[model samples]
Target: MSTPDAVPVSLAEIARIAGVGRAAVSNWRRRHDSFPIRIGGTDVSPQFSLAEVEQWLRDNGKLTDVGGREFLWPRFEALGSRDESGLAVAEAARRMRSPRTRSSHPGLSDRARDLAIEAAQLGRREGPRETFEFLLQRWLETHVRQLSTTPAQLASLMTRIALAVRLGASEGGLTVLDPACGTGHLPAAAAQEYDGEDLAVLACERDPALAALASARLGFVAEDRELRTEVATADALRADPFAGVRADIALCNPPFNERDWGYEELATDQRWAHGLPPRTEPELAWVQHLVSRLRPGGAAVVVLPPAVASRKAGRRIRGSLLRTGTLRAVVALPPGSAQPHSVSLQLWVLRAAPDNPAAASPGQDALFVDATRFARPGVREPGPDWDALGSFVLSAVETLDRPDSDPPEGTVRVPLLDLLDDEVDVTPGRYTAASAEPSGVELAASWGDLGTLLADLAGHAQHLSKLGFDAGTLQTTATVGDLVKAGALTLRAGQQPAESATPPREGAVPLLTVPDLLMDGKPSGLLCADSAHAVAQEGDVVVAGVVRAYKAWVHEGPPMALGPQLYALRVDPEKLDAHFLAGCLRAPANGRQAGTHASSSSRVDIRRLQVLRLPLDKQAAYAETFRRLRDFETLLTRTDSLGKRLVSDVSDRLAAGGLTV
Candidate 1:
């Protein structure tokens, strides 16, 4: 069963095992590189090791119904009594130990992670739809974090979207559409809750790769033959994939921040009834597009950029839509719900109720939520958190159902009059008054006082500056190698996993990753705990050898440690200003030296770091700047902490039936 690639078995063997032709296997092989590669014997014949082929097949979509034991045992029996399959499995297990393999196939560690995510959806019974939804979610989730969403925020959004489908939307005959379906998670989520003979859904995506992926996921859903759903690959705006067709609901999360939408060409088109959307405002165009595809009274919940709520050009279109009464509720999302970026988002729930008065609720009385402060700590992407947003939206929608009447249980109601009185500001903060202040202002003040009382260690910064001296001349600046020669700093190599003595604790402290340093430099509060061991201590000057990055932080607490892969420069304070040492590390000449000293494998030599040349006083001044910046950041954190505690307290009370949002 072994092939040239390793433990027997080849791509041909896998094609034979799956009863598919070689072309099919080759196509999959070409598309996904992780498809097992054979050991180095080149051949005209497409080859694969049985172990690698089986692993790839299992990972992609082949052995789902079969439990792991069943999947492995049969292959073992089919092979030989000598248990070659066992050896292959063992080899694959060993491959898992490799960092490359681990990074490539993170899914292997916990195949059930998707299932666990689905378990969060309460009212929905687990079924094939749920399984497919979870699978598609995991697949789409792979790139959304990179495309825009943060990993943590993406997880929360997927969970909330799943719960929304399970709780609020009827699954019996649901049909979903996303006009600007990026990677198609919405339709995929719909396919999970309502993919049977009765339910059908379609997703329209413009990006070819995303459209293909959406097609694959939705086709995979309907591929079972019993399901009745499909994802269409096309521009939802220009060409309505579901044109001349009606949907039960048109759920979308369209692209925001787009300046131009092809409006001039579609001016005479029938979708824009309320008003013509300004060229600068594309959101209204999407709004019209979503409404046009929905059946009368059919609900469409779309996520929009904050500008759509109150931007000048957005106002007229928004007003017309409100006057027409299709606009339902506008739920303000916490910032940073999307990652690598932070812009406030709002959920616009519209229905094709051309005659419904609620849509035309007097004078722009849309339900506004001030969810800006509603976020939980820990890996909150770049903006406001929207982890619990769906629940809030669901609650608001339920309240809206009893329009003009008081809400029951967990709902807050504000008249549109009140909203207008607030100058048509759609931010939820415009409606809701500030909640109780921090419970421990006295403690905060005391801490502030303590910060003030801490004796200011006298430094030569003021004196040197007053004398018109260029502070960059303290040390006859040497390269990092020279510093190493002086024994002022050293590089500690990142240990291989096999060489690691300390196993990673689930949540001890963050182990900084290459990505954690994204966005120009390291984000102030980011830390990763994925690794077992880390290096760097208080007052350590560190540089990421792999990332070619540098950062200097005075670890205020012992918890502020860095990855071992990073080089820590322990400078003699009397000899060099640690801040200045960091600045030298950033110097172009020092960078060249460090690059020269870096290992062939890309690891930087710590000894080379100390060779850089820097003036002493300049180092001190830089250190002073770092200190002030850190202190200011600490104060900002305190202010945020107070806000977070306020929201948390309110959510707790609401959950306990003592308060409402």
Candidate 2:
């Protein structure tokens, strides 16, 4: 095999990297003075050395041809197990990428083009392993989304796992193992966690190709210890690579909806101490395999389909485990935790033996953690928090597993009798209490005080309509300027006042500059520049507004200095509802139309806004709707927040391992 790092790139490489014709580089050098030149010259093509060219591209803020295509490099020989740079392979890849040359290879299909691109990327080394990991991660993200999960769900899962490691009951040289290791992710995570320690991980993959790839990647982390490094190509259920071995912890996310999992052969297995798992239900089989492998008093966490928690066939096995007092905790994650499919996952935490052998206080109780409530909106992952749930579960395990300790209060303890009564209903929500009321009771209590406020607003609208103003009802239509008598809406057009126009004055009121108005009619975080020309009288609609697709915020302040793009509308006494008009103009539909008409550039022009047929009444009607919508949104936000907090608090208590489920 060719030395992986000793590979060289040539003129064809330059064409591929730049995504331009070889002649384009020649034309640029011959015609432009900006091009670089090699020290030894004319005979060799004018392509700059790769490193120098890369640096120049970076300096100019230009993308190299291989910029987004970095995924093609590092895996060349390793993936294909080739020693030398296959000239035929390189030539084939080059021809496939070039449309002009592609016609000559009519035999190649669209699939062939994809393979060729992969080949090209596999042969280069633009950065370190971390960069390659990023590329690999993105690829895997796309694959998972295509298969069943979204990039967001994967990210959420990873975040939860990291959080668990950081706060959970894991201790004394942490270790991790994945029985059904796909690409050895669990082991790789373990490798990362135990970077400097002698950590052991055994991964079993049935697919030879995948096993080879995973073994190659993890060998560096595993070092030379066989126990620390095992990537055997065998079925995990039928063949336990580390047969009698155990670890500090085990983490697994097995394939779901599996049926006919070799139940006939493993019926009398020692792992099935709880009860024999039915052949029709493979989920329980995997669960049994994972639980039995745990060391005495060791903890095991596994992701399972929600059905397994209540399935009748698996009920006997699940009930046996619960009755034996080995079942520790169960947490139900929110739906959409695993993207695309939106299936909620339940995490089952089981211990091999009780922590305190002599004194068992409610050891027969299993903690039910309903963490479905604590999910934050932005976490686009498999579900709520696996890591958080794991941490809470481990914490419970620590306290409950101890030789002598009181079962902590607050954690709900469901006795085996209760579980039996419910017919082995292991769902967390089935045992935990419903969420408490929100804390903002005062805000809710004063809602009956809104009638007067509504009357006042209505009276103001009716008074405006009587003054020959069409502001109350959505009937009369008029342009903004038509209704705004020149004196009424004193249009204060913005100006770019000089920096030296005015110095900061002591106790000076802040200005309402263009930057102060956000697309959402909110003020920006920026402080406005001082200007004597800028001023805002009370009741004047300060529109530091812009007409654009992209959103921006204006600065906070009353008499703010406005940028050239700003337009301050000082409302004439009965002509328009200045607040209502500002909101209508800043509406998303209006901004989108304005953006459509603006000149094309790096940024949209926020000044070309035009309201051809809009009237004051329509603006008022819409404004009222917006106000009510905002109130509803606020209520929903509060409700969601309260629900999540309760779930988090409850999950924390249950994870201490003291409560029974």
lDDT of each: 0.53, 0.52
**Which 10-residue window in model 2 sums to the lowest lDDT?**
78-87
State in Å the error of residue 1, model 2.
Answer: 34
Q: Write the per-residue lDDT of candidate 1 for residues 176-275, one digit (tens) a residue.
A: 6666665556765665654345666666766654554455455555555455655565767677767887766777777766665677777887888877
Local accuracy of candidate 2 as per-residue lDDT tens digits, 485-514: 444456665554332213446654443333
- Shift in Å, residue 158, candidate 2: 9.7
RMSD of candidate 1 to the true fold? 14.8
In candidate 2, stretches whose alpha carbon ends up further than 4 angstroms from where it belongs are 1-61, 64-128, 145-176, 194-197, 223-227, 339-341, 354-356, 359-362, 378-411, 435-581, 586-661
Give the top-scoring candidate (TM-score). Answer: 2
- The TM-scores, one per candidate, come to 0.49, 0.55
Clashes of each: 38, 39
